[model samples]
Target chain A: MIQWAADVSMLVIGVSLLLSLWRVLIGPSVPDRMAALDAATANVIAGIVVFAIRDDTLDYIDSALVIALLSFVGTVAVAKFLAKGVIIERDSD
Target chain B: MSEILTSLLILTGAFFLLVGTLGLLRFPDVYNRLHSVGKASTLGVVSTLLASVVYFWAQQSTLSVKQLAIVVFLYMSSPVGTHMMARAAHLIGIPLAKETQRDDLKKRRGSVPANE
Candidate 1:
């Protein structure tokens, strides 16, 4: 029963991932693409958690953690660049 | 019993994720898209993580600290990231959709300079 549930949930998440990918591909503006990318990363993390649960393993949670951290950093960097035209500002002025 | 609960959580999480992605695809503008993706996906991811936490605890009779950490991190970061993205869009002058109703930020900020 749990296995069947896992399978169904995975299918649903797979569809969600694909839809986010479609947005990424066709998004007209930079921030639109960024939002799609962010959603995709979240979807992937959820997928990893589900996979770990289905496999009855705890190790994959670490990978999810790493991905979450990296994606947050990447999103912030890109956002800073978009806002300020530079990722690392040298001076307040 | 626990399996049913876990499954329900997982299914609901998946539904929220689907809705978020659909919004990302269908929303007209970046800000609106951000609004949809940010809230829905965060809830979805958190729900899924909770399901996993429950499953692990049921199987092993102990909680997984790492899963909880991931949930905490996600809850903290996703909103910040979305806000940053929205601010960036505003700073970069991404125009609102044609159907937008108001420009409260513009009114509050005393109008953007003609050059910007």
Candidate 2:
């Protein structure tokens, strides 16, 4: 039963990843692409979780944690750059 | 019993993830896409992570701290990332959808200069 569930969930995650990839490709603006990329990152994490459960191993959980951290950092950096035109602003104060 | 619960949670998470990606693809504006992906994907991922915790605990009788840490980290970061993206888009003067009736931020801030 768990195996079947993992397979089905993997299929769903695959479809969602493709959809997110489509958005990333054709997004009209920077934020659109960023949002799609962010969603895709989350989908990847979900996939990793399902894989871990299916294999009955705790090894992949570390990778999931790392990916989540990196994606968040990437998103924030890109957003900051988009808004301010620079990642690190000089303190005027 | 635990297998049944795990399967149900995984299916539920997958459903939400599909819905979120669908919204990301179809939404007309960046803000709309952010709104959809931000909330839906976070919930979806969280649910799946919870399922992993449940699975590990049921099968091995050992609690998984990594999954719980991921859940906490995601809950904290997803919203912040979404907010930053939306603000950045706004600051760069990305136009809204035709259906958007009001932008209180624009009204109050009175025109954020496009930085780029």
Candidate 3:
């Protein structure tokens, strides 16, 4: 019975991932797209961890961590750039 | 013990993720969508990660700590990142939905901003 839940969860996660992708594709503005992309990244992270646990692997978890770090920086960079036209600014000006 | 617990956790996590994604797609504005995807999904991942920790620890493996750590890290970071991104968006003057009746940010002076 519990295994049934595992399978069902996998299906739901898959669908959720798909929905996020859809949002990413159809988002009307840059910020909307950015938000969708961020959400997608989070979805992928969750999916990876769950699947890795199901398969009993530590490798995926490590990569998931890396992805988490990279995605956060990337989103921040893009959003900052879009907002202020710069990612890093020196106060020496 | 591990199987049932892990499966239950994964299932619950997946449910939140599904709703978050749905909210992402259907929400009228970017900030609202962030509430769904960023907040809900972050919680969802933590639950799933806890499931993994339980599964590993049940097998007498000492590696459950690693899973717990990752879960905790994700939980801490996801919302902060999302908030930063959303705040950036709001500052940049991203358009809100037409139906939005109140915009407290607009009423504030010196509110950091411009995305568009």
Candidate 4:
């Protein structure tokens, strides 16, 4: 049952990743691309988790956590740059 | 029994993840897309992680702390990231969909200079 579920979920997640890729390819605006990318990141993490289930190992969870942290930072940095044109602004106060 | 529950959770999570991506593909604007991605994907990922926790606990007779940590971290971070991206998009004047009824931020911020 776990094997079957993992297979199905991995397939579903792969399709999702493809869909998000399509959105990224033709997204009309910057945030549209960013949103797609964010969704893709989530999909990737889901894939990794499902992989862990399939392999019956705890190894992938750490990598998923790392991906999550890195993607969050990247999203924030890009969003800040898009909004204010700088990731780390000099004192604005 | 535990396998049944884990499988159910995995299917549920996958369904949600697919829905979130479909929304991202079909939504007419950035804000709408962000709305879809933020809520649905987070739920999807968390559900999948929970499934892992269940599977490990049932199989190994030990809790999966890392999976639980990921779940908690996701809950905290997904929204903040989404909000930051939405605010950035708005500030930079990513145009709203034609069907948008109102923009309260515009009223409050008093005419952001269009940068996009």
Best by DockQ: 2
Best-to-worst lDDT order:
2, 4, 1, 3
What's the number of clashes in each of the models? 0, 0, 4, 0
Ranking by TM-score: 2, 4, 1, 3
**DockQ of candidate model 1:** 0.79
What is candidate 1's lDDT per residue for B5-75, written digit by digit as tens?
89989988989999999989888899999999889998999999999988988999888888889888988
lDDT of 2 by residue, A1-88 (tens): 9999999999999999999999999999999999999999999999999999999999999999999999999999999999887898
TM-score: which candidate is best?
2
Q: Chain B vs. true chain B: TM-score for each candidate? A: 0.91, 0.94, 0.84, 0.94
Candidate 1 recovers what fraction of true contacts?
0.89
Name the regions of candidate 1 deviating beyond 4 angstroms: B111-116
Stretches > 4 Å off in candidate 2: B111-116
In the order shown, the candidates' DockQ scores are: 0.79, 0.88, 0.66, 0.78
Candidate 4 Cα outliers beyond 4 Å, as residue runs: B111-116
State the weakest 10-residue window (summed lDDT) of model 4 chain A.
A84-93
The most accurate candidate by lDDT is 2
Can you write out model 1's per-residue Cα lDDT over A15-45, one digit (the tens) per residue? 9999999999999889999999999998999
DockQ-based class of model 2: high
